[model samples]
Target: MGTIKRDKGLDNTLKVMKQGYLYITNQRKRLGSENIFETRALGGKKIIVISGKDAAELFYDNDKIERSGTLPKRVVNTLFGKGAIHTTTGKKHIDRKALFMSLMTEGNLKHLRELTRNHWYMNTQKMEQMDQINIYRESIVQLTKIGTKWAGVQAPEEKIEEIATDMDVMIDSFKGLGGKFKGYKASVDARKRVEDWLEDQIIQTRKGKIFPPEGTALYEFAHWEDYKGNPMDSRLCAIDLMNTFRPLIAINRFVSFGLLAMHEHPITREKIKSDDDYAYMFSQEVRRFYPFVPFLPAKAKTDIQFEGHPIEKDTMIALDIYGTMHREDVFENPDDFYPERFKDWDGSPFDLIPQGGGDYYTNHRCAGEWMTIIIMEETMKYFAERVTYDVPEQDLTVDLNSIPGYVKSGFIIENLREVV
Candidate 1:
């Protein structure tokens, strides 16, 4: 075994900042190393960036790496929330994760899909009255409504826009420096208000002041018990509830990419309209081809070695999610957008993780992934068959340097019309 190659620099923090999603893969190509390399980032913190299927498998091993203390403090405060499930491990993680997994049943998924389709129809009707709309912006508002309602949280009709904007700002905070401070502020403020509201609901549910449908996420999470058979911390319960809500709204990014794919590959639109299976394929391709989550961070739980590289206990490691999905060996012509490639996909957990890899129930994989797919498939079918809108000439380039990238023009559309 050989020592892992290291990039020479005082620190690669600026390199990572400048390169964003391309940082790791670019270094791999320049150094000609076998999918593992070391660099310093974020104020000179030693980070081992790893890619490829086997590396991902190793990275997710619970005994080797742990999620706690891996994410940036700012990230936890802004995006994930303090005490969120993303920060737990062992039996605590399993018990908390079960609350989320329980809400992912077939009946619940069908209910979410119905809510999504209904919201889309209402939003499209409103859009038809206007001259143009940004699908990315519209999706945030629409999906927020669907997410809040389906999760059994009640938002007044008037406050949905405010709540939606806060969620959007929280996600946007993880990206560029220009908006980072403002995004952080928004996240802090939003968490306080949202958590306060959710705590009230949890209290109401516990006291019978309000009854969320028994099987709904709101009620389940409100009443969920921890490993000690005590009710979860009210604030933590609220944070976990937002975990279910926020990611659904964040699917707007993928929805925007899905629209871009259809516009670029017009032929696929007809196939998407005619074949349900094809729509699912198109959704998978969009996830693979786009840049959403760039990387996932974890910490070495104990001194360990991978491919002869010694990782000290508590050393930070980054799994290159973008690089793995685009690895040439794993994905043929990986840069090209091709939906048909998924027709015979082998379903390897590590190969195609736009979300985190490994078993959802036991690992740190995004619990809301199935709900994301259901929403995307429904959105594709809606755009293909039930709605018609013109994609006006606009900048459609996706900036690789942007974390959670978006179409440059947010996928503008005009002259919206309902097919019915």
Candidate 2:
């Protein structure tokens, strides 16, 4: 009998080192490796990393590689559905991404940022009334309501509150609540609410009761195609938008965390605040330090041999963002939260990927990364300077199995009594 080895849930890649890539173990006990030269994990699912700028290049490389198969698709269908971003790959993914990018131009983004600033100011003003507030949770609710709504999507306020409540319930359950059964129930309930809301929105938009602006990414995505080449039905587009929206919500949740990091590390915060381009640098560093996603899961595309390892097709491969970010060989003082490190680095792009690199748009790369950076930079600076928060004794919690966390939304930010 073949004995099964359970997944140990370690930073799999971090534990093993080979010539080009580090090895990882899947649930099936398959081993794969990823490194500077090439990536072959889950038996033989293959990709290349090469260096830092290569990371970005790989992200933009759409023609040769794409996101497909069971793991990613299943997760998307379960969590995000067949939306414009996660549901499709290749040319279609590029087209959809292009639409999103085009809509994310400086002018549109500038407008979005202005509205966001107003929203943040308003929210923060309300928070100041209480000496102590849960900035993390409050930020999540505010960002979901204000952030996406400002981005031109009409997210229902009540629904946003419900989802926030559900998420918290699950988190509480994870932290060991006995009665709620919160994790399982919240996941199931949230999916239903998301589906119902998406259906209503699609029907409403189709009937012309609402119309997104002509160049709006969501508007374009309403007619996007899937890998099978059919235009995404309005229903699917609605579902997809929700999926895209979730990450934005999550990223913003951490934007508050980034602000906390900066406020605590005054020297780093002040340095970033002092320069124009440095704001972006700071945001990148924040992304690196407290990334929204740690494991980017992918499946093997075909059967192939790589680096003398025989990996079968269809195995699950999880790319390690946390490990890569902290790898000493790649970044000097790997654990330090230094935004300026990127400013001086001349390495390839593959080395520093908070976002997945190489053909990732069609794979697992984030569509809203540009907007995420913009929002983080804007939000981080605003809070670091204008708002001050008193964090609890815990600085950051290491999720060990998931994304790294520090100073979760458990603290209160004081000062600045009203939004302008």
Candidate 3:
């Protein structure tokens, strides 16, 4: 059995995700703790491989399968705070989700689209200066800024960028299980800076009274009271904005993963560029190939059996997203990068899912699914037409169990005009 080692380098992690199961099954002969193998920890809980689509469907029914294991407690405290959204139960979660959905109306969508386009044009030029930049980091900053602005928080780019970086660092601190303590410490400092920044913005907005006379997303939300009818706390509102950024960050990470797949599999890239509808199909393939959250956990609400394994009530169910997507039994040539698999089809077969969903706007299923697709389609088109760069001689191997290496170099956009 391989000992689970902490801090395996990027290269090694990629290797583990891609083939760790093969090593465990055929070579190792038994599932090891070091390997991400499905095993029963507590008595009679069925832990098995699952894909994004199934996970989405299952998590959508979250009430039936209550999330058993805890997400990083530090993350909950730092990013979401003890709000109606983050830690709430029963009616509270439902109501908070509704509040979040209210902000996603067509009016806000238009504003966000305009902001995203402007940011892309403004940032593309900046990218030309560096040999290579982390697209994931870049997208996160832009998206975070956009969300903050929607929340009526306005500040200098430098200041906002600094805050964004701190937020990201706080998020990264919680990468592996049991690292919640590390995140807890970082979140203290990070949370304070963010809260102070948000508090000032709320004060300024209220004082200026420049909000739309009738109502804006921010205005309506700022005025939103809980079930008891008390005014929502301004401090919690800012932290909610921070939580909004988390999913966006995760979305962009998967988007970058899609970009990497396109670069490496130019055939799929060409298919996507040929037609607009292909954009959605291409996204499905990308979702199947590269989702950020690999293992999503849900607790059993009652005793159940999946594939003959008895799962007791209240046990954590580890759904293996990567394994489900890559399973050959469900997908023909599952390893191949093919977009046609999702074209106008039911999309149930391939189990493609970029965003997790058991219910709309719940679990890891992003509320910004449409928003993410729009960005991905537009950005992929830009890169496909405008850029051409050789990947340097290096190991670009990927692992299903580990995070992928973000592209560091080997891309050049020769035709900026093609971005449109």
Candidate 4:
């Protein structure tokens, strides 16, 4: 057994906020640790940071670590609502996951992809009329509409932007309480507004005031029975309904990232348009190369040994998401933006964990992961093949120091028009 490197500090909480996505990786580099290190933060709360394939395997090992009550209240209240599946454990997790997986049918996914393409085609008309468009802003509106429509939740045209902004804020809230930049106040209010909106829909569903089509997300979750054969709490049902499609909205950032990629790597952009398979690879690379989540936390279920270090029961363990995907041992020249690498990529869940690393059915992996891929692929191909636009001079830099970063100016584009 080996002694794990401990951070020399009373607390490094503020450093994490300032460092953002690179915090853990920065720690490992400074500590000269292989894959695991300990950091004291949140007023000396012991946090074990683990990365790479082995750490992911252990993190998702339900017997070793569990997720219930692991996320901070601020995270739950904003990013994932109370009683979300991200906080489930044991048998309940299985049942709750089944509820989500049921909605991921192949036919349903196809419908979503079609919706993505349709929305993009429509948005181009609006973009063409305008002198310029912020890809990120327009993407939020289009994705929110697609997600709500696919989930059978109808948002009035005027309400789409509001709903989208709220959802986007919820995702951005993952940074937790970090001064004014984290937007803590906005995070709480965003969840409240969205929850109330969806709860009302759940109510209307029950009273038959609204008809969410069968096989759609809102309909299934609204009528869902808990593992104990009881109707789930209305708020939980609404949370799950949002869970179903809100992630589709989450892909809005990826739309911007994918466009940014096209602009930066012009050769790959031309390659992606002609090659469908390469486009999928490009989408996967976008998810891998860009930052989405920084880390995910779980608590040790019992005393366990990992990487020659002891972890006491109930210790908080953070799976280093950004660090894992960018590990050189996993990807050659890890810093480079290369899509071709995925062509020969081994299909290990732990290796490419931008969303998460585990069995989709039985673990806490993003249920809408497939939707992210589908939407990203469609968005990548659309802008690559269907639309012609100019990448105006703007801050295209994606700050590694930002949690869930986007191109600084949202990847500005001007003179948008249909492809010849």
* Of 3 and 4, the candidate ranking higher by lDDT: 4
Worst 10 residues of 4 by lDDT: 173-182
Candidate 1 residues 65-111, lDDT tens each? 88887778787888888989999889989888988999998999999
Per-residue lDDT tens digits for candidate 3, residues 128-161, read 6656555667667876776566555565777877
Cα shift from native, residue 222, model 1 (Å): 1.1
Q: Write the per-residue lDDT of candidate 2 for residues 121-186, one digit (tens) a residue.
A: 777757777766666777677667755564456766667787666434322322211122335555
Error of 3 at 277 (Å): 1.9
Task: Spell out the clash pairs found in candidate 4.
Answer: none
- Candidate 4, 1-420: lDDT as tens digits: 889998778888888878988998888998899799998876678989898999999998988887888788777878888888988888888998998899889999999999999999988888899988998888889999999999999799999989999998888887664434448789788888888899999999988999989999888888988878998889888887888877788787888988888888899878986786988899999999998888988889999989779999999989999889898987889899999999989889898999898998888988888889999888888888898889877888889987768788988899998987
lDDT of 3 at 314: 70
- The lDDT of each candidate is 0.87, 0.54, 0.56, 0.87
Cα lDDT for residue 322, candidate 1: 92
Q: Give TM-scores for every candidate, taking all chains together and pairing residue i with residue i.
A: 0.97, 0.74, 0.76, 0.97
Off by over 4 Å in 4: 177-182
